[model samples]
Structures are given as structure tokens and as C-alpha cells.
Target: MSDAASRLAEVETNIAEAARRAGRKAGDVCLIAVSKTHDADAIRPLIAAGQRHFGENRVQEAAAKWPALRGEAPDVTLHLIGQLQSNKAEEAVALFDAIHSVDRSSLVQALAKACDKLGKRPQLFVQVNIGDEEQKGGCAVADLAALLAEAKAAGLAIDGLMAIPPADVEPAPYFALLDELAERHGLPLRSMGMSGDYEKAVMLGATHVRVGTALFGARD
Candidate 1:
């Protein structure tokens, strides 16, 4: 097998093992290959491997790469998994099938306005700072109730909650908290976990997992 194919196989094996250990079916967790900082050349092989969902961190970077990959992977689903600024909300709405970092009311309002003007409402997920870290981009856990209320009132379809636990912390508890919050708000998608902790996330009921390095090898 080629280098990319070998990496893909290794990732699949890891995911399957994680799922097995968690006592969950392997298909229950959707793998969102995070292609951030990588070019289309790196992504195309994964696309050919039947990976349909991908995530990117920057609007400008995705804007440049997506069009070039469009012809080769027309049916791929793209997700914007970074902090989306208000000025870029319109483009984000147009570019991604879901925005997984809607952390503030102002950003929600901007996205709503953009969707209203464009007549397209993409799926949204509120990012909760489960670790309560001061430096993170997500909203405080205490603020989630109000944020959920605001998102509901704004007519945004909140699929579920997303979170990044403290890098040094175990992810299971934080993933559980996000699952609980999503249940409280009647949302269905729990987009927690990354390459390192996705199996634990699946056991806790994560509908989606953003995995990059585990699949593509470490980024520079």
C-alpha cells in the first residue's frame, strides 16, 4: 500500500479498537477528518478512501482548498470547526454544512442574519468550555442555558453541543457533560472528541468526532 493508504488503514484500526473497547458499534461515531493546515493533495486520497466528511479551521484556507477539491470530491461534507468571526459568518454559512463553534450570542446573531439573507441555514453547535479554562474560545458552562435559549429564539437549528476539554485533562467527564447539556436542550448531535479521545467520546454518545492527526499523521 502507499503511504496515505497505510495511514488510513492504521486510523481505521485504531477507531475500530476504540469502539470495541467502548462496547459501541464502530459505525455509531462519524469520523470528521480534520484537514486543517493540509493541502488538497493530502485530502484527496482520504476522499478516495470513502471518507465523506472533513473539517477545516480557517475560512480563507478552506475557501482556497475546497474549490480545487470540489471536482474530485463533489459529495464531501465540509465542517467549519474553528472560531468563526462575525465578518466571515456569511461565507462560513455558504462553505460549511455545519459550524461547530458557535460560542457567543453575537456570533449566532451574525450567522442568523447571514442565513436569513442567503436563504440557507446550516446546522450549528454551541461550543461549551467544559474545562472552564479561561483561555479557551468556548462559552463558560454556566452560560450555556442562556446561550441555548438565545439560539432557539433566533431560529437556528442547534444540532447539539461541541467542546474541547483541557488538553491536560481526561476527556471522558467533559464529553459526558456535553452529552448531558445537549439532552437538556433537546439537541441530538454531540460533537466532542478528537484523534486522541474519540472512542471515549463514542461511549459517552458523541454523534461526531473530529479526527485529523490520527488519520493524516502529525501536522507541521
Candidate 2:
């Protein structure tokens, strides 16, 4: 098997083991290959191995890579999983299938405006600062309800909530909180977890896990 395929198999094994430990079916979790820094050459093998969804962090990087990668891996679905600047909102809406880091009203407004111009609206997830960490770029937990109401009012399709628990704490409670918030708001698709804590996320009912290092080895 090719190197990337081997790595993908290993990741699938880990994900399956995680699901088994969580008493959930492996198919319940979706593994989004975090291809932020990596290029098309690095991701092609995963595509060949049947990975259809990939995530990128930067607008410029995605813009640079998608044209070439899309032609090669026509079935791949791209997700923008990073903090998006308003100036780049139009390009991001054009390039990504979903935006998982809508943290502020301004960003949402930009996306709405961009969508209006494009005549297409990509799925959106509000990023929640469940840990209340000041450094993170997410709406404060107290603000989520109002924000979700605003997003709905703005004609945005609120797919779910995305979060990154404080790096220093256990992620389970935080993830569960996000799931609760999503439920309260009548939203589905909890996009949480990473290589380190994805199993806990699954146990807490994460529909989508953003796995990076476990699938790609270590990043530089």
C-alpha cells in the first residue's frame, strides 16, 4: 500500500477502536482529513483510499490548492475549518463546502453578503468558546443562543456548533456542553474533537471529528 494509504488505514483502525470503546458504531463518526499545511501531493493517496472529505485552515492555501486538487480528486469535499477574515469571506464561500469557524456577527454578515453574490450558501457552524478561554476565537458560551437566533434570521443555514476545548482541560465536558447547546438550538452536526481527544468526543456524541496528526502523523 502507498504511504498515505497505510497511514489512513492506521487512522481508521484507531477511529474504530475509539468507537468500540465508546460503544458506538465506527460509521457514526466522520473523519475529516485536516489538510491545512499539506498540499495536493500529500493528500492524493488519501483520496485514492476513499477519503472524500478534507479540511483546510487558510483561505489562501485552499485557493492555491483546490483548483489543482479538485481536478484530480473530483469527489473530495473541502471544508474551511479556521478563523475566517471578513475580507476573505467571499473567496472562502466560493472555495469551501462548509465553514466551521463562524465566531462573530461580522463574519456571518460577510458570509451572507458573499453568498448573496455567489448565489450559493455553504453550510455554517458557529464556533463556541466553551472553555471561556480569552485566547480562542469563538463566541462566548453565553452569547451562543442569541447568535444562533441571529444566524437563523440572517438566512444562514446553521448546520451545528464547532469548538476547541481549552488545551489544558479534559475535552469531554466541554464537548458535551457544545452538544447540549446544539440540541437546545435545534441544530445538528457537532463538529468537535481532534487526534488527541476524538474518542471522548465520539462518546459525547460528535457527528464529525477533525482528525489531523493521527491521520497525517505529526505536523511541522
Candidate No. with top lDDT: 2
* Overall local distance difference test of candidate 1: 0.87
Q: Show the lowest summed lDDT stretch of 10 residues, model 1.
A: 2-11
What digit string (tens of lDDT, one per residue) describes model 1 on residues 27-66? 7777899999999889988888778889999999999999
TM-score of 1: 0.94
- How many Å off is the CA of 165 in candidate 2? 0.7
Clash pairs detected, candidate 2: none
Error of 1 at 106 (Å): 0.5
State, as a TM-score between 0 and 1, how close model 2 is to the true structure.
0.95
lDDT of each: 0.87, 0.88
Off by over 4 Å in 1: 20-23
The alpha-carbon lDDT assigned to residue 26 of candidate 1 equals 76
Return the TM-score for each candidate structure. 0.94, 0.95
lDDT of 2 by residue, 1-220 (tens): 8777887888778778878887889898888999989977778878998888899999999999888989987878889899999999999999998899998999888888899899988888999988988888999989998888787788888899999998978888899899999998888789999988987888788888898887777988
